[model samples]
Target: MSASRPATTTAPARPAGPGGPGGRPGGGPPGMAAMAGPPQKALNFGPSAKRLLAQLRPERAAVALVFVLAVVSVGLNVVGPRLLGHGTDLIFQGVIGRQLPADVTKDQAVENLRADGQDTFADLVAGMNVVPGQGIDFGALQTVLLGVLALYVGASLFMWVQAYLLNTVVQRTVFRLRSDVEDKIHRLPLKYFDANARGDVLSRVTNDIDNVSQSLQQTMSQLLNSLLTVIGVLAMMVWISPLLALIALVTIPLSMLVTAVIAKRSQKQFVAQWAHTGALNGQIEEAYTGHALVKVFGRQREVEQSFGAKNDELYQASFGAQFVSGLIMPAMFFLGNLNYVAIAVVGGLRVASGSMSLGEVQAFVQYTRQFTQPLTQLASMANLLQSGVASAERVFELLDEPEQVPDAATPQTLDDQPRGRVEFEHVSFSYDPEQPLIEDLSLVAEPGRTVAIVGPTGAGKTTLVNLIMRFYELRGGRITIDGRDIAELSRDELRSSIGMVLQDTWLFGGTIRENLAYGDPTASEEQIRAAAEATYVDRFVHSLPDGYDTVIDEEGDNISAGEKQLLTIARAFLADPAILILDEATSSVDTRTEVLVQHAMAALRSDRTSFVIAHRLSTIRDADLILVMRDGAIVEQGTHTELLERRGAYFDLYNSQFAAPDVEEE
Candidate 1:
């Protein structure tokens, strides 16, 4: 994986205040308004989501089975209580009371049983005839007990099955999502990365996706189970006593109202929490990357103070969001208890007055509890639901962001063996629409020719090379390769044809050979060794105890800066791209290493269309053409000797470097 390079721009004299378009100062509120506008809502899963889900569609049968099992599990748990109540009522009136005759009118028998206080098992069975060994037709009691046990067992088994299936679905979904997100990150334009922070992007890939995964894994199932329980309980309650059921439902609307308000407030806070987290992550990454500078300047106290303030801001936002969201469950529980008390009181009186059986009252109380439990759970999971939605919004925002440079609708493929002839015609570009960074830039590097770009910092030198690589689009004019507009060529085709060695060298944690072979995975051991030798990286690799298999940590911290740059050049050599772009590839090397790198670069440029951004004027003096740029346009263009003879901007720049030694001598 290629690490993105930072855009080259002139450093502002003073840091912009909070809310500036560039970025906010430490720990300040995020400038949401300064960032890109809110993205359009296209689909539930966004484009990336759709692509990911499609991959999992082949397992739809498993997903469907899981959903069906869940529904059945919920149904059984809900209806089991009603079935028990029916059996209890039958035992009390038809068997235990003895008011029921061997043959009698059913309605009469039931009415007589009620009059005789046979509504409860204890009262009805007290005076009943009992067999010596059987104890009052114990057969009926055994049957009822067996039925109740069966209901419980069935419900338990179903619940277990549902849980197993749900977990399988969630794990699979997350796997697919992560894979697709990583792929898209690879496909996106480099310019897209320039406008965003690495920490923010990383947060989206790791933290945000985990939030969604947790929601799906736990919250979704809980919500579904709760909803089914509530519905089943309400049905049974109505059957037992409609009046009691209505009374139990009185608190629902109030609970809902409270939930709506809390959720709305929490949404805003959750967004703020995510924003603060990104800022904090950015701060940590920056400090770690520049740790040497901090230590050298003895600025540990300043760094700590800055970090503490950012951490504090994150703490306040997260605390407020979680605390408020957490309150909903307890609030719902209290209200549910209040509802339970009212129903119990009312149902007890109905049973005592002989209007309802004791069995009916018990069932009504149980149903009331069942209804309240799900309601409580639903309230508790509300926070998870909101967090998932917020994460979804951020994930979708990245997927929705317009590509910096649109790909051609009918892209052409490069020839199997490309003869690189790169040309730019009056090209212009700007990262921000209002500020043009390059204007009317025209240049060409014929096949097997080296073109050197030299200018002051922020003079659009790098931007010119970026256009040739199609990292960004030309705001005006066109770029052509082999007589075809580069836009008409597929991005993959264009980039794969060019090899780049940037000033900043980044190496992932891996073996030395793995880093060298990154650009061409199929390279043989011999090819890898040859490329390494050519770039002088083989010298360091052989010195390590493990040779090519030596392990390196992130950013190749185990190696010196010169070695890292050499490794990157080694990677480019292995790729053997038709066109090469070297952006200060030798900038960090000492004079000794620079000589080695220059030798490798000269070898690389042979028979290749090459563009070099050189800060050391001495290295590029023999180039066929030298382009001098300033403030987004070409200020001077000629060979080094021709430019010196012309005595213009290039002459002055060249003279300044030589004048420094003379001044020291004086």
Candidate 2:
């Protein structure tokens, strides 16, 4: 179910420059503490007024047509009432008030005219022997009635057309907006995803966009139609009787004030409701993704309790928002009823005193009702509009986020035959500057050699590889590929020269061949099989019911962990990069699978500079060089035998893993 939340804060005022708060150029607020708040105001949505104006894009053309049609429709409606009143006045003067011509009494003139017409008709119909004076003309009455019908028909047709056009525009515009929002989510930087929970992001893209779409599709056209109708009705009311028009308008300002107050409160509630929905979605996603772990740990009750809290929060928020927004309709209706009663009472007294005609009073009442009808609709739809605005603000917030590190303007391609030499000069890095993960350090890996990085968790082993691939930029220092600074090389070109296989294997939802082809999209079927065979994944894949055509489920859950690792190896094999980084690539496999993977690695390492982050020292025992790292710095580097002889961190790590367990004596 859809839910809403109160807005916690006003949207931020636009900054004069890209720099926010302090004077630092392009920097966010002064410190990390400032980041904790309601999501930053959408930098690109502009002021609230501007955002409202932007919403008009959907109905601009429709609005113009509505204006023209309303003017014409109102003119026609007014003309009919005025003509009917004139006809009534003429009848009263000629028949009831002795205001006819003085040539004869009213009855005598009517009799004489009827007799003359009957004789003339008898002369013309002599040959046919037709009867005379059988039917009355009543042409004036018929003409007025037909004219009124025509006017009503024209007004209704225009109204229908206007409604259709407005609604069509609203739906189309909203569809495009939703599509654009989804596209932007995919284009956002990886760091954004890291900072925000996946569930929250998904909620924004789906729930928030859906809310905006629904509001537009359901309420926007009604709003436009009502607004035009109200304007037209008010104009007719003034034309009918200025005094009654003034009485009807007296309640309008009061109604608007009441609506404004309610809208402000409802807008806040809607914002809160939306936020709670996001929180609830986040909780649900966490529960499902970790279902296996939660069940294994017997944390079902705890999970349920957490879910219940979030569910209750959402319920409260949604109910409150709806309840508050719902108030506008009744409030407006109350005022509209008051205005109607006032107009009816005053118009009745005027007509009774002969100050206004019966027809005029009738038309006046119709106009007053028309005026109230649109106002009522506007009050109701204002709630939807405010909710839509809140959703738009969230969506724009994502689109407006700064893309800080764009690819280079002019990128240099890597050499086709790269020497596989990598060097880091004075490199320092951090996820947050206050807590540096890696300090100023330098390292080198030569051509066609294996380099094993051994470090405790969080010692920056993975960070080093990430930097080499330019996934994250260094705060200080430069990294070079084949003697060329990596920053100058095209990002695509730099990455294409490197291959990585991590501990966690990610196979997308596709056939085995498709997953392998991801590494080299143009690779032939034979080449793909060769890569799979090299990694020993082909044996298991071929055993599957569909062989290579078998589809992998999300996270590769359909296959064993060992098989997923093998598939990843197959991908890397197909990539055939000049440089390879293996982060515990064989850690998940069994002894047999590890031996097979080791063989695959041996084949892949030829003429490639390989960096292996090893947990099991036995896997990298044959490396050409081993770098024992501690606290993000290399402590020792040499062949495995040389490091063992030195008896340093490497020797200690190797002994811990390969050391025989003590036997118990009975």
Candidate 3:
């Protein structure tokens, strides 16, 4: 009876909607949009990226500290080249000075050369800070070297600290994000799951979240370092020689142009890539979940073809995103090289003319390299940053899904002693507003009575049960228990008093005793065994090697269907609910097991309000009330003999099965 049925006719299908993947009914691709192929751009890159960044808001202080550390580290690193250049000047000046005559002062030698028509050489000598006959000063050189080492050490220490803090902030932020997503999932309505693929939702929860974590971890600190390094290096370059600094600056625009062009093209591809990943995951999940069905129907090839199509789409999207973003690094490298050559030629000429010292030129070259290197690094990281943001957008989309209606702010409670007298008055409902499933239906089940519902497949049998369970809201009218409107009571409190055994038995991977305890967590071993015995579960369970301790497999395939059904009934008994729902509970068991199950059912149903949905008429022959349903309406209601005497819908349905067999025997 819980078997998958189309939406009730009361809720008719809506007209084709405007949004969702493939314009699916209800909404698009569950909580996400569908992707057919690579798009030209992301749907909302700016807002999604902003939202992703917002995840760091709670860690703003830690992030700020990391930024400060990065700045200090870059500043210390920037001074290293200048200090080294000073040492080089000291060594060069000493070497040049040592070769000159010891008797002549430094200025006297330069003036003598100017007097001898060698002013060019004199000017070069004048620019040098050398003693007339001095050799290399090991003491000064040692001091400079030590200072450079200290700067590097300090920079390294700060960078290490920055990295530690950043990792902490990132992990904590992602941890909270993961927790929020998990909670939000539970809050989503059942219809959302029914409309969306499980694999797709799983990809968003698991894969996309992981990608966001990795992206932030890999890209955040490095991007900050590169940017700060660029700024610090540029300042040093300008201080040393503005002319050469200007040459390096030319590459900035080139780098920007390359990044903007390639990143713009690649962002869309990255979005497509992630979208395809979700789609592929969905197909794989569906394929594996129904592998046996596919094999039995001989449709393996079709499933394979579908998988191949989705896989190919993912590959294409990945290739396009990677190929486009990949161009950024190379282009930046080429432009950087060109800038390097220009600065080298110009600096060398300035040094020869004595307008700039040899050491100054050396420092400028170092600065040029530092400036270009970070630009290249930034270009290379564009792909990672884009990819991470793309994944974040997908996750954000899931978190943004509309949640189910909220519980009442002040919920009413059932009486301590529940009577289980359920009444449905003028109830109208539908899955879609355009269609009607149940309209103005009224029924009253007095306390402790068994009401049997018999109908064809689409007669809204399960729908009625779902209403009592409040799985969906009513369009009009209300359902009440003990005169208290169900809508006023909290869902948890309302369902706590009811027990249900569905046609499709569900058993988790656990010991038999543990599964039984699931019905009532506080149930003791003695109570558990009592329920098991009552449901006839104690019979087969003892035959197993471990008895109650025997573990059920993940799929619960270790036990027969009948055994599983009995376990569920035992679980229901353990719950000791005031009301019970059995949806074709005995349909799976053999006739002999059915007889045993009937005894258990009778015991379980004692002094409890019971709703039995059955296809086999004989199973409910002794039901207190037999309701014949047709097209979402109750056509007849009476005891077994009274319905037969009426010779109406119930009589015709009954004779259709039993009368045919009698006629054949005759």
Q: Stretches of candidate 2 above 4 Å error?
A: 1-49, 52-172, 175-183, 660-666
Per-residue error for 601 in candidate 3, Å, reads 1.6
Better of 1 and 3 by TM-score: 3
Candidate 2 overall lDDT versus native: 0.71
Residue by residue across 1-666, what tens digits does model 3's lDDT show?
111111222322322121211122233212333333334456476887788889999999999999999999999999999999999998888888887777898899999878999888787788888788889999999999999999999999999999999999999989999999999997886557666677878988999999999999999998999999998998888888888888889888878988998999998889999888987888888788678789999999999899999898889899999999999988988998898899889988887677888889888888888888888888998899899999998888789999876778898888786879888888887665655657777787878888899876666677677778776678899999988899988889998988988877889999999999999999999999999988889999999999999999756889998899888888988998888988888888888888878877876677888999888898898787888777667777878888899999989888877884645543
Between candidates 2 and 3, the lDDT winner: 3
lDDT of 1 by residue, 1-666 (tens): 001111233322222121111112341112322233222332233444344445457569876786677678777777766666655665555443453354544445555556777665323333233221221345766786687788778878988888887788778877777887787786776655655666777788888889888877778678778887887788878877889989998989989998888876776666667767776777777788889989999999998998898788779878987999998998998998899889879876776565676567777777878898889889988877766766766776676666556678889888778788876777767655655566565666678878788877656566667777776667788888877889898888898999988877888899999999997999999999999988888888889999999999986888898889889888988999999888888887789988877877887788788888887888888676788766666667778898999999999989888766545543
lDDT values for all models = 0.73, 0.71, 0.83
Off by over 4 Å in 3: 1-41, 112-121, 659-666
TM-score against truth, every candidate: 0.85, 0.82, 0.90
Clashes of each: 0, 14, 11
Give the alpha carbon lDDT tens digit for every residue of 319-359 in model 2.
88789889998898898888888888998777645467656
Report the poorest 10 consecutive residues by lDDT, candidate 1. 15-24
Q: Give the clash count for model 2.
A: 14
